[model samples]
Target: MTEPLVVEFEVDAPRGHAFDTWTARCGLWWPKSHTVSGDPAAITFQPRPGGRIFERAADGTEHDWGEVLDWEPPGRLRYLWHLFFDRSEATEVEITFTEQGGRTLVRIEQTGWDRLGEAGPPRRDKTRQAWTAIGEQFRRACQ
Candidate 1:
């Protein structure tokens, strides 16, 4: 297995603001290229343990991407993620939000690529790139 994919960046907003942007306002910042449907009408996290993380299309079609494992507003969120994969190949992702001089530092740690067998490393690399770009997108939205 490869090391967990880690990505960190700062948001101009405070911790709670940043966290809210990431969760409540996700449909506004999330890029279509990063979504399972590419153009989901809405993407949402159900906000509690065992809750669903999913996408809904304009046609009302829904597809689940993950499940919430832990939820701590303005502090941390841990979930099982399987965006374009089967649930059997789900990975774990934990994101933390920390306040820094009025700003928020967001960190994402994702692991469990080993389940994908030969496709693991490359998928992990792709997600790393996606997260890096998303960090910037997320920051702008938080402001």
Candidate 2:
């Protein structure tokens, strides 16, 4: 197994609050520029196992993004990330929140990318960078 892309950050909120911000209210903070279709208004997540993480187009057409794999509130969330362009492949993303001294530490690890072959490295790095930016946005939203 290869090394997974890992990104970490600290938010000024408690673990439960941070988790809620990231999972329950992610659409409010996630950068709209990060979406593949270039529409952030259409993106949403339900934050539960088997819940749909998807996007909608102007025509009301919905695109399947992925599904929640695990839903441990206030601490951990694991989900399948499928951008849909590669239907055969699915990436696993795990986000964990830890409370320390009244602050929440957010750590994201993304793996199962070997299927991307030579593109895995760049993809991993890009995802990490995106997550870092998104995390910062989440932190600000929580503040």
Candidate 3:
């Protein structure tokens, strides 16, 4: 099994607000280049177990990015990530929010790269870089 990719950062917001920004306002912060359509009109997260994380294009087409496995507001969220658009090749992602002083510490960990078969390592590396960029965007959004 390949090691999980973990990214951690601090945001200048309370835990609840940070969590809301991450889940409910993702479209405002998520990079358009990261979307499957490359031109998504909006990104939406259904904040419950078995709910969806998806992107909607200008034409109103929705693309599935993953399914929620767990949801705990202001604290944690876990989901199956299928950003490659293939559920069979999906991995698991867990994000946690912790309040410290006057800031929120956010941590994201993605695992199950072995499911990607021969492409696992390279894809994982690419995703790590992408997540770094994404994390910065999230942090800025929370500020």
Error of 1 at 87 (Å): 0.8
Candidate 3 to truth, TM: 0.96
- Residue 14, candidate 2: how far off, in angstroms? 1.1
Worst 10 residues of 2 by lDDT: 34-43
lDDT sort, best first:
3, 1, 2
After superposing candidate 3, which stretches have Cα over 4 Å from the reference?
Answer: none
lDDT preference between candidates 2 and 3, better one: 3
Prediction 2 global C-alpha lDDT: 0.81
Query: Candidate 3 at residue 91, lDDT?
Result: 92
Q: Write candidate 1's Cα lDDT for 24-111 as tens digits.
A: 8888898888787789998899999999999998888999999999999989999999988899999999999999999999999999
Q: TM-score of each candidate?
A: 0.96, 0.88, 0.96
TM-score of 2: 0.88
